[model samples]
Every structure is written in structure tokens, then in C-alpha cells.
Target: MNLGELEKAALQYFWSHEEADAKQVHAYFETKRGGSLNTIQSTLDRLFKKGLLKREKQGYAYVYRQAMSKDAFIGELVADVTKDFFKPTENALHAAFTSMSSSLSDDELSELETLIEQQRNNARSE
Candidate 1:
């Protein structure tokens, strides 16, 4: 499921809040971008069509929740991007790691190194 910026924002809102009404989502976005209620409604409709959100009737309103967990959705998104743009190449992985490394703390780098060693050992065993 390819999500647009607004869809991503909407999904994140639902993810953080557990459940959100259309009005709440609109209000949240309004604090940032100041879009209309109709705009928010349309974006929610698009997210629903894309199967990224589930809606349930709540009184006179609809409450939205994520159709998938955040981690699962992010993993799928990363896999899709890798498959589409990187052809699952080691060079792409290297670039991603290098880019991430620049932002990591010393402890994080150490942890990543340990993870790499574990992956290498697993590969050797395989």
C-alpha cells in the first residue's frame, strides 16, 4: 500500500491515538497545515480506499484505526521501496546504513555493529 503524505499523517494520528474521529484528525492537521474539514475527510476516504485504515461508526461520526500495526506497515513500506528502487542490492543497504550511521550515537553504533556480527554469524551457519 503506497501512502501519500496526508495518508501517512492520518495513519500516524490513528496509530498514536489508538482511534481518531475524522474531526479529531482534521483538527490535528489543522494545527499544522490549516486544511479544511472536507480536505481531511477526502484524505481519510483515500486512506480507507487504500486499505490503510478501518472505520467504524461512532454515533454521528466515524472513528478510524490503523488496519496494520505501525511496525508491520513500516517494514512492508521499506521492502517495497527496496524492491522498487534498489533491486535488493547490497549497495543500497550500505548506503542506507551509512546514512543512518551519521545520525546514530556511539552506543547505537556499537549496537548496530553487534547486530551486524550476529547477522554474519547467522549467514555463516546458514
Candidate 2:
């Protein structure tokens, strides 16, 4: 899936903030990056349509929140890319992690290892 610059920015905004209406989101971006409120509303609507955001109509306007966490979104993107080239076998997954680990710092690798251990434990319990 391709994301435009504004779309990516909107996703990041939703990830950071719990929920926001179009005006609130537009105000947040105004000082940092200038954009019209209509543009921000369009971006939010696009994200909602893409299923990256959840929205509820609150009286006069809709308030939006992220449909998934940032990590979940990244994981989905990784899975999407990996599925195109590999069948998702254990060896393929291991190779992918090993290659990706080359750029990670020691602390990040440790955190990754912890997450993997948690997943392993969860799988065992299930």
C-alpha cells in the first residue's frame, strides 16, 4: 500500500494523539506544517476509508482515532511485503529478522527479543 506524505503525517498524528476532530487535527498541523483545514479533513477521511482510522460522529463532527497501533501497522506492511516474495516459512521469517537486525541497535534488538519471547509464551499458553 502506498501512502502519500500527508497521509503518512496524518497516521503519525493519530498514533500520537488519542482522538481528534478535523479542526483539532488541522490546528495541530498548522504551526508545524501549514495546511488548510479542508486538506486535513480530506486526509482524515481518506485514512478512515483505508481502515487505518476509526471515526464516530460526535454531534456536528466526526472524531477519529487510529484503528491499529503503529507497530501493528508496520507489522502489516512487513507481512504484505514479505508475502510477495516468500511463503512465510520459519526459515524465511528467521532470514528476514536476521537481515533486518543488522541495522538495529543492541537495546532495540533486546526489545525485539523480549517481544519474540512474549509471543512464544503466548503461543505456548494457547
Candidate 3:
């Protein structure tokens, strides 16, 4: 899904904080980003409509939080971007991961390897 700058910033805020009303979000962004409360409210509404945020009415205002974790959002974005061009295959996926991992440090690469091994073990059990 496409996201505006404010939308992305608002999502970041939700990821870091538990939940917030529009005014609180505006307060957080007022100095750093300099947008009005209406803008913040609209951004939150848009995010809620897009299913990126969960909101429920609290008194007269809505309190919002992220619908998914940051990693899940990123995974969806990666899948969305790659879906059109690639007919995913094991080798293709491996190649893509290897290419992406090229910039990783040794420790990060080892962590990735451990995760892969854990996935393999899980799959075998399943």
C-alpha cells in the first residue's frame, strides 16, 4: 500500500508508543514535524481506513494503535513489491535473500543463518 510522509511518521509513532489520540499525536509531531491537529487526525483516519491502524472510540475521540507489528508491515511491503515481477521459487527466494544479505555484518549473517536453521527445524516438525 502507498503511504504519505505523514502516514509513515504516524505509523512510526504508533510502533514506538502503545496508543495515542489525535491530539497526543499532534503534540508529539508539532515541533518535530509541524503539522496541525486536523492533519494528524486525518492521517490517523487514513491509516485506520487502510487497515494499518486499529482505533476505538474513547469518550468522544478515537485512540489509535498499529494493527500489525513493524516487522509484519515490512514483510507485507516486501511481498507487495516483489509479487508482480517474480513468480517466487526456492532458488529465486534464496538468491534474493543472499543479495539482500550482502551488506550484513558477520554477526547479522550468523543470526540470519540461525533463523533459517530454526525455520527448517520447525518445518520438519510440522
lDDT of every model, 2 decimals = 0.83, 0.92, 0.91
TM-score of each: 0.66, 0.88, 0.87
lDDT tens digits, residue span 1-126, model 3? 899999999999999999999999999999997988999999999999999999999999999999999989997887777676677554455556778999999999999999989989999999
Off by over 4 Å in 2: 87-92
Number of colliding residue pairs in each model: 0, 0, 0
Q: Which of the predicted structures, 1 or 3, would earn the higher TM-score when compared with the native?
A: 3
Residue 34, candidate 3: C-alpha displacement in angstroms: 0.9
Clashing pairs in 2: none
| Global fold similarity of model 2 (TM-score) | 0.88
Clashes by residue pair, model 3: none
**45-125 per-residue lDDT for model 2 (tens digits):** 999999999999999999999999999999889877777787656456666788999999999999999999999999999
